[model samples]
Target: MNIKKTVEKIPGGMMLAPLFLGAVLHTFWPGTGKYFGSFTNGMITGVVPILAVWLFCMGASIKISATGTVLKKSGTLVATKIATAWVCAFVFAQLLPEGGMVKTGFFAGLSVLAIVAAMD
Candidate 1:
């Protein structure tokens, strides 16, 4: 299959595809990373280095003059995410019982902590 072309066809597909695959892998076979003794284990478990490289690449790709623009855009995105999360938590708090949890129903076992964590 032409992975590059396929990924390019969808917006943000390049990043999303790998993330989806990783989530599936973790969901179905959580031990796969530890089961692999060498490079596979490192590739799965050693995310910090990979994240550092990705962050470095992202930062490196931006022009020096666009630093302010990047900062402003990222700041706005972060603020929006926090605001949205807060609003969601507040709404959930109102929907949930006084203990801030759903005890019985389709949403059983859900709590404010879970909502906040999912939002974050």
Candidate 2:
């Protein structure tokens, strides 16, 4: 099967494919990272730092010659996204317990961090 072609046919599949795979892995084998205990564990737990560098590169790619109007619009959209995510996180925090959600129920492993990441 042509996995690249299959993913290309689905809207946003390039982004969603890895997410689906990760979710499956986390659900079925949450200890897979710890089991491997080295590079695999680092890859699993080091997502934030890697993502920060990727995002920095993305931001740095914006051309300095872009018009003020374009920058303003993009800035407004980004601000709105951040604000909405913050509000959602705040609401989730209020609803969840002090340490966050439960670890072994229907909502197991769901946390404010995940919610914010999904929202933003």
Which residue runs does candidate 2 get wrong by more than 4 Å?
A: 1-66
Model-by-model lDDT, in order?
0.84, 0.80
Cα misplacement distance, residue 48 of candidate 1 (Å): 5.0
Q: How accurate locally is residue 31 in candidate 2, as Cα lDDT from 0 to 100?
A: 93
Candidate 1 residue lDDT tens string, 34-56: 89876666656677755676688
Model 2, 5-108: lDDT tens per residue? 99989898766775677678878998987999877766565677546655777668777777577779989999999999999999999988778775787998
**What TM-score does structure 1 among the candidates reach?**
0.60
Q: CA shift at 28, candidate 2, in angstroms?
A: 33
lDDT of 2: 0.80
